[model samples]
Target: MDGVTGLDVHTLGIIGLAVGIAIALSFSLMSLVLRGMAALHVWAAAFWLLTFAGLAQGYDENGSFLSAIIGSVLIALANAAMLIGIAMHLGHPLRWRGPALVIVLFLLIQVGFMVWPPSQPLESAVFGLKSIFWDGWMVFFLLRAPRELKAGSLFTALVFVIDALFYVARGLVSLHPEMESPELASLLTTSNYLFGILCTFLLSTGFTLMLSQRLVHDLRVAANVDGLTGLLNRTALLKAAAPVLQANREHTHAVLLFDLDHFKAINDRWGHAGGDAVLQHFTRTLREGGIPARALLSRYGGEEFLLLAPCTSANVAVTLAESLRALVERSPAHYAGEPIMFTTSVGVATGTGTHIQRLIDTADAALYQAKRTGRDRVEAMVSDPSAGDRVNEATSAASALT
Candidate 1:
């Protein structure tokens, strides 16, 4: 095949090797900076293996059996590694058995070909079929990715689909060897090399973009979520609720404020670790307690939580609050195999319009009332004629207790 085209297969192989090595190095560096992303490391190793495969195939001037077998196996393994890395990135479970069986079968076929050398077209057909299988497998997974990763996933899937089409064409062309003149064969080889280079670069770029998108999503989550309870933070809750509140101005919204009763005592008795465990326990209870799907639940601050339920009535809000209080009271948090008794005080306020701050203030006043009367109780204040009357009443009552 040498000198069939001005830029020969060997030259293309060398260029591919150089490009693979460069990409491998970039992925390796990315793995270092993005420490926990195991996909980056896997992809780096895959590129290195692909480079080795290129080297094994490129220098085989005599088309040696050993070089052929080694190159085929390494190339297959590299493709498998790429699929594995993609699974890792998407948090999908790795099912090694299927991929392993495919690789073993592919290796056996390569070995069979080496033992009884077939025509060039037959060999090319086998290679093309194998390439198509792997590329198709990658496309399947990429297309099924979650909505959050749709952009990068779709782009990468499209690239793989194109690659599969190339292999399909190669296979079809190889089947009709009688139609392949010297000039046409040369053109196909040149096209293959150029397309191979293009696909390799595109695959790497697509993977990098996926990693970038994932990183951005993770950073955004970290910023808006409470590290301990995995609940939305105050800022995130406000940001999320503002639009909903404004959109449903005609509908009533309920804001429920909850303070864990005697939280400091729990910390004092069982230490901060125990306190953390209790907080987690409470969070789980809330999740399992049939909270409305559209409720905006957040960790307002230490030992304080807020829930904003849109399109809810005052009665429903108070009932929900009481249910939560009872649930918490009955469900004891265990620390060191001992049951740690604890409870929560809930204050609920319901109103129409987009005055989220006003609703929160009213809920705060009611929360003060709950604390004053008795901890572990549910108290509620509805929006009165002036909207300030209930808040004033609760505040005056709270002041009397003080």
Candidate 2:
């Protein structure tokens, strides 16, 4: 292999090929393990395409036009695949027409260059511009990613920008080769191959980090959220509200416990599927009824939900509960051409302390009172100031109003 100073371009290419293959194999295995992540499969395919592109370009001893065209087209397709994978990862709709057009135009331009034998500088400029186009598109999308994935997305975008800068430098240097020393040109070529190997590894690592972050976030959400109603589960609600409750002992916090009235009867009349529809409908109604943003809402158990609102007074809590109850009563869940009307009984308790369980117990007592008096009503209880931090028993001061 010819050496550019102490560095060998051929050896760098060989190492890049090995590294690309290893990364591709790793992605392929990950895709198999994470079958739901479609982006991984696309990325794996992209790497394989890149490897083939390298092989096609490397073994073309005579610089044959066919081999050159094959290599160029394969590389363009590989980049296109990568862009598509990014789109998939971000949950964006795939639009392949533009990338396909770019590839076709690249192929046609390569054919033109082969036939007319363009100057080396012009060829390098065109190649570099093509790369910049794709890199710019990828950077745009990465920058537009959601804030939660900002770290990984920004790192990947930075790497792409650096790679694009290298291409720009290569084109600029090739443009005025007569002004530079032979050693400089050789060094640039060697540096290009070395950068290629390094960039490929970095890109792969960045993508894997992005994927791992997404996976961890999804796992956490799945663990905390109720699958049916898409609300926080009991344990999650309790865990999340603990800090809020403990933060300010003087602030009044309220817990609203809601029990759907006659839930079992709905299931009996409409089957389990219809009952599920009603549950979803109730959740939507509660959301649409202007629930406070600061409130922590969760499905506490079967046909029961709990909402913890910090800095809420007794009056505000009761009003919110009444509003939700009325909203649920009016909104009917439809299933199989039948409307299933349902209602809920609510228990509201307000206290000034970190005793969350005490507040919940007081709210549950109020809820029991509401159910006992009649279903589909709101009952409220407030802690007695004389009792200090202890949440007092349910009070009749704010009685269930029909």
TM-score of each: 0.91, 0.88
lDDT of 1 by residue, 312-349 (tens): 87767777787788889899999899998999998888
- Lowest lDDT block of 10, candidate 2: 388-397
Query: Per-residue lDDT tens digits of candidate 2, residues 31-129?
Result: 999999888899999999988888888832245865679888989999999899988887777799989999999999999988898776787789899
TM-score for predicted model 2 compared with the true structure: 0.88
Off by over 4 Å in 2: 1-11, 59-63, 92-94, 179-189, 385-402
Candidate lDDT values, in order: 0.85, 0.84
Q: Write out the backbone clash pairs for model 1.
A: none
The best candidate by lDDT is: 1
lDDT of 1: 0.85
